[model samples]
Target chain A: MRQIKLKERPDGMPSAKTFQYENVDVPSRNRDEVLLKTLYLSVDPYMRGRMSTGPSYAAPFKVGEPLNGGIVAQVMESETEELKEGDIVTGALPWQEYIVADPNQLRRPEVHGAPVSSALGVLGMPGLTAYFGMYHIGEPKEGETVVVSAAAGAVGSIAGQLAKKRGARVVGIVGSQSKGDYIVNKLGFDEAVNYKEENVSEALKTKCPDGIDVYFENVGGEISDAVWPLLNTFARVPLCGAIAAYNLSAGESDIGLRVQMPFIKSRVKMQGFIVGDFSEHFREAYEVLSPLVKNGELHFEETIHEGFDKVPDAFLGLFSGENVGKQLVKVVEPEQ
Target chain B: MRQIKLKERPDGMPSAKTFQYENVDVPSRNRDEVLLKTLYLSVDPYMRGRMSTGPSYAAPFKVGEPLNGGIVAQVMESETEELKEGDIVTGALPWQEYIVADPNQLRRPEVHGAPVSSALGVLGMPGLTAYFGMYHIGEPKEGETVVVSAAAGAVGSIAGQLAKKRGARVVGIVGSQSKGDYIVNKLGFDEAVNYKEENVSEALKTKCPDGIDVYFENVGGEISDAVWPLLNTFARVPLCGAIAAYNLSAGESDIGLRVQMPFIKSRVKMQGFIVGDFSEHFREAYEVLSPLVKNGELHFEETIHEGFDKVPDAFLGLFSGENVGKQLVKVVEPEQ
Candidate 1:
C-alpha cells in the first residue's frame, strides 16, 4: 500500500516537497472492521488551514503524520454485518491506497443515478456547505441580487446555483473568463464578473444595478473590498472562506479597508460559518440538495486528477484557480 | 430665538468653528401644528457620521442647515386635539431653542416617575438601541460571558446591564479608571477593563476566564481587535457603533486586522444595526425596559450640559471621553 504524509509545515504556499510518499503493508481487519480500497479522495482549499499550526476550525495536521481527508472507498472484505464486501462507503480516512476502517466510521452515500465520486462533490461536504451557507445565512429573497466570489469552485458553484433556485438575481465573480462563462452559462447564474480581466467593483455596479442584497464571500482580500461598497441596506454576507489569505507568511497581516463603518451604515449581517456548524440538520440539507442533483435542476462540475500521486498537485492548483469546480484525486477503480 | 447651523464640514475632527450659532425668529404654529420649546437635546456619536459627506446610515448634514437629533420639547401652543400647551413630547428636531412641528412627529414618553430627560437617554433611542442590539442580536445565555466596549457610554451601559439581567457574566471595557469603576461598582458588571491604563486583551483574558460568548461592540479599532481572539465558539457580536473610525480624513482608510479568518474559526455572527431596524417592535422593547427602569432594577446616568450654546461642546466631548453615560444638552427649563 502507498500513502502520503506531511513532510514539513510550509512557511507560506505549499509545494510538492511538503508531502512525502511512503510504502506500507496493508493491515488485516479485525472483528467489526472492514478492509477497504480507496477509490476517490477530496482535495479542498480548507485543508490548507489544517496543514499549518494556526487557529482554525479544524486541528492542525501533525508533521510526519499521514495526511487524512474525505475518501470514498469500496469494502474488499467485511467482518461485520453492518457493511458487506463490495459495498461503497465514504469516510474521513488516511490518504492511502488500501486501508482498514470500522464500518461505523463510514457511510454509504445514496448515488441517486450519479457517479459514486459525486459523493465527494455535490452529495458531500461541499454541497452541504453551500446548502447551509446560502439557505441559512445568505437567505437570498426573491428578486434580490446575490454576488458570489469564487463562483466556479466547489462550494461557490453550488452556492450560486442554490441562490438561483431561490429566484435571486445571481452574479458570480470568477478568476478566468472560462470559469465565469461556466457559472453563467452552465450553472445559470444571471451574470458573471471575471475579476482577472475586469474591475470587480465597477463591473459589479454595471451587472448588479439594483445593488447587492446578499454577498457570498469565499475569496477575501481585494475581492471583498470591491463588494463592500456595493452592498445595499440590510445586506447579508455569509463569510464561508478566505482562501486568498490562507498562505500569508508568518507575521504577515491580512489588512484591508475596515468593515465596521460600511457595515454599520448598511446594517449588514456578516456571519462566518463552516458546514459542521449545521451538522445536526445535515439531513435537511441533503434532502434539499440530493433532489436538485437527481432532477438536474442543480448543476456541478469536477476536476479529477488520475492516480493517488496527484493529490498534492491537485490541492496546490486550488490557489492558482486551476480547477473549475470540485478538485479530486482518483485512487483506484471500484469493481462492478 | 437661537439656532446652530453646520458652518462647514470639518476636514477631520470638528471644532467650535464648525458650528455657526445664529439668532432667529421663533416660527409660529400653523394648522395641525404645535409650537415647541426645546427642553433637552441629545449629542450622540452617530451624529458625527452626518457631519460630512459620506455613505452613512443618515444623510450628511448640509453646510448651511441646522443639525437635527433626538430632542425633548414642551408644547407651548397646540393647534390640534392630539397635544396641548404644557404637554411634554420628544422628536427628531433641529438644533433650535423653539420650533414648530406637526403633532405626528412627536411621541409622549412614559416617564414612569423618572425625569422627562430620560426620554432622550435610557427611555428613548439610546435605550432602544441597547435593547435591540443586546437582546435580539447578542442573545446572551445564562452562565455565558458578555463583553461590552464603551461600557460607560449610554448604549453600552444599558447593554451591559441588560446582559447582567439575562444572567450572563458581564465584562465592560472603558477608556478611564472612573468609567471602569462606574460600570463595575455602579452598573453591576462582573469585571471592567480600563483600556487606557491596562492591556485590554490581557485584562479581558484574566477577567473573562470563560471565553466571550457575546460582544456588544460600541467602539471599533484596537478595542475590537482585543475582543476578536477571545471570542468563544458561536459568539455573537452586535455592532452598534464604531466611533473610533468616524473621523478618518478623506482618502484615509480605516484599516485593521481582517475579521474573516477568526470569525470563521469561531463561527462568529457580527451584525451591524441601528434602533430603526426594530421600529416595528419598539413597543415590545419599551414594555420590557420600562418596567426595569421604573422598578429601579436598571440604573442610568446623564451628563447634562446647561444652555443651548453648549451643544457643540457637549457633542465634541464625546470623542474626548469627557462625559460619562448619555451626553445631553439642556436647552431650557420647562415653564411649570
Candidate 2:
C-alpha cells in the first residue's frame, strides 16, 4: 500500500517538499471495521487552513502523520454486519492505497447512475456545502443578482448553477478567462468575470445594474473588496472560503478596508460557514441537489490526478490557482 | 430658530467647513405638527456615512440641506393631542434650535428614572444596537470570551457590560489607556487592551487563551485585524461600526490579513445590523435595558456638549476619537 504523509508544516506557500511518500502493506480489519481499497480522494481549498497552526474549527495535521480527506473506497473485507464485501463506501480516509475504517464512519453509496467519484465532488461535501450555504445562509431570491467567486470550481460551479436555476441573474467571478468562459457560456451564467484581468466590482455593477443581492463568497481578498460596495441593502453573503490569502503566514494580512461597516449601512448579512457545521442538512441538501444533477440542471468538472503519489502535487496546486473545478486524486482502479 | 446644514460633502475626515450654522424663524405648527425645542442632539458614528455623497445604507446629506439626526426634543406647541406642551420626546430631528414635527414621528420618554440622553446612547439606538447585537447575533454563553472594539464608545461599552452581565468573560479593545482602564476598572471587564501602546494581537492571545467566541465589532481597522485570527469555533462577530476607516475617502490600506479563510476556518458568523432593523424588538430590548440603567445594574457615561452650535464639532469628534463614552450635544438646560 502507498501512503502520503506531511513532512513539514508550511510557512507560507507549500511546495512538494512539504509531503513524503511511504509504502506499506494493507492493514487487516478488526471486529466492526471494514478494510477498503481507496478509489477517489477529494482535494479541497479548506485543507490549506489545516496546514497552519492557527486556530480553526478542525484540527491541523501533525507533521509526519498521514494526511486524511474525504474518500470513496470499495469494501475489500468487512468484519461488520452493516457492510458487505464489494460494497462501495465513503469515509474520511488517509491519503493511502487502502484504509481500515469503522463501518459507522462509512456511508454506503447510493450513486445510482452517477459515477462513484461524483461523491467526492459535486454529489458529496462540496455540493452539500453550496446547497446549504446558498439556501440557508445566502437565501437567494428570484430575479435577484447572485454573485459567486471561483465560479467554475467544484463548489462554486454548482453554487452558480444552482443560483441560476433558482431564477437569479448569476454573475460568476473566476481566476482565468477559460474558467470565466465556462461558467458564462457552458454553465449558462448571465455573466462571468476573469478576476485576474477584469475589475470584479465594476464588472458586477455593469452586469447587475440592480446590484448584487446574494454573494456566494468562495475567494476572499480583493474580490471581496470589489463585491462589498456593490451589494444592495439586505444582501446576503455566504462566505465559504478565502483561497487568496491561505498561503500567507506573516499572521493575518492587514488589508484595511473597514469592510464590515457595510453591514450597518446596507444591512448586508455576511455569514462564514463550514460544511461540517450543518451535517444534519446533508440528506436534505442531497435530496434537493440529486434531481438537479440527473436532470442536467447542475453539472460539475473534476481535475483528477492518476495515483496516490500525485496527491501532494494536486493539493499544492490549490494555492497557485492551478486547478480547474474540483481537484481530486485517483488512488486505485475500481474493481469490476 | 437656528439650523445646522451641510456646507459641503467631506472628502476624507469631516471638518468645521463641512457644516454651516444658520438662523431662521421657526415654522408655524400644522394640524398634525408639534413645535419642538431641541433638548439633546445625539452625535453618532453612523452620521459619518450620511455626510458623504458615496452610497451607504442611509441617504447621503445633500449639500446645503440641514443635517438630521436623533434628538430628544420638548413639545412647545401641540396641534396634535398625542403630545402636550412640556412633554419630552425623542425622534429623528434635524440639527436645529426649534422645529415643527409630526406627532407620529416621536416617542415619549420610556424610562423616567434614567437620563433621557440615554435614549440616544446606552438606552437608545446605541444601547439597543448593543443589546440585540450581543444577544441576537453574538449570542454570548457563560464562560465564553466576548471581545469588543471601541471598548469605551457608545455601542461597544454597553456590549461588553452586557456580556459581563450574562456571565461571560469580557475583554475590551480600546484606543487609549484611560479608556481601557475605564472599561476594565469601572465597567468590570475581565481585561482591556489599549491598542495604541500594546501589541493588540499578542495581548489578545494572552488575555483570551481559550479564543474569542463573541466579537462586538465597533471600530473596524487594525483592531479587527488583531482579533480575527484568535476567533474560536462558532465565533459570532456583531459588526457595529467602522470609525477607524470612516475617515478614508477611498483606496484600501494594507492590514496584512484577509478574512475569507479565517472566517470559514472558525465558522465565524459576522453580521451587520442597524438598530432600526429590529424596531420590533425595541420594547423588548428597552424592557431589559431600562431597568439595568435604573437599578444601576448597567452603568453609562456621556460626553455632553452644551448648545446646538457645538453639534457639528461633537459629531466630527467621532472620527478623531476625541469624545469618551456616549457623545451628545445638550441643546437645552435642565427643566423640572
Number of the top lDDT candidate: 1
Candidate 1 segments exceeding 4 Å error: A257-336, B257-336
- Scored against the true structure, residue B262 in model 1 reaches a CA lDDT of 30
Worst 10 residues of 1 chain B by lDDT: B327-336
Return the lDDT, model 1, position A111.
47
Report clash pairs, candidate 1.
none
- Candidate 1 per-residue lDDT, tens place, A239-321, comes to 67666676777777756534443343334454544333344654443444334334543223335566433433543443233
Q: Find the 10 residues in a row with the least total lDDT in model 1 chain A.
A: A327-336
- Rate residue A36 of model 2 by lDDT: 78
Q: Evaluated with TM-score, which candidate comes out highest?
A: 1
lDDT of 1 by residue, B1-336 (tens): 777788888776666666777888998778889998876655666677688885654679999998787777788888699998888888898878788999889988654445566556555556666666776678899999999987777677777877887899999988777767777777788999988889988999999998888888766678887777777656777767665666667767666533543333333454543333445654453444334334543222335566534433553443233442234444333221
Give a tens-digit lDDT track for model 2, residues B1-336: 667788887777676677777888887777888988776665565677677765555678889988887777778888687988888888987777777888888987553345455455554565566666676677899999999887776667767877886899999987677777777777788999978899998999999999888878766567777776677655677666656656666565524324432232233343433223444544454344334334543222334555434433543343233432234444333221
Tens digit of per-residue lDDT, candidate 2, span A92-167: 7787777999988888644434556655554555655666566656777789899987776667776776676678
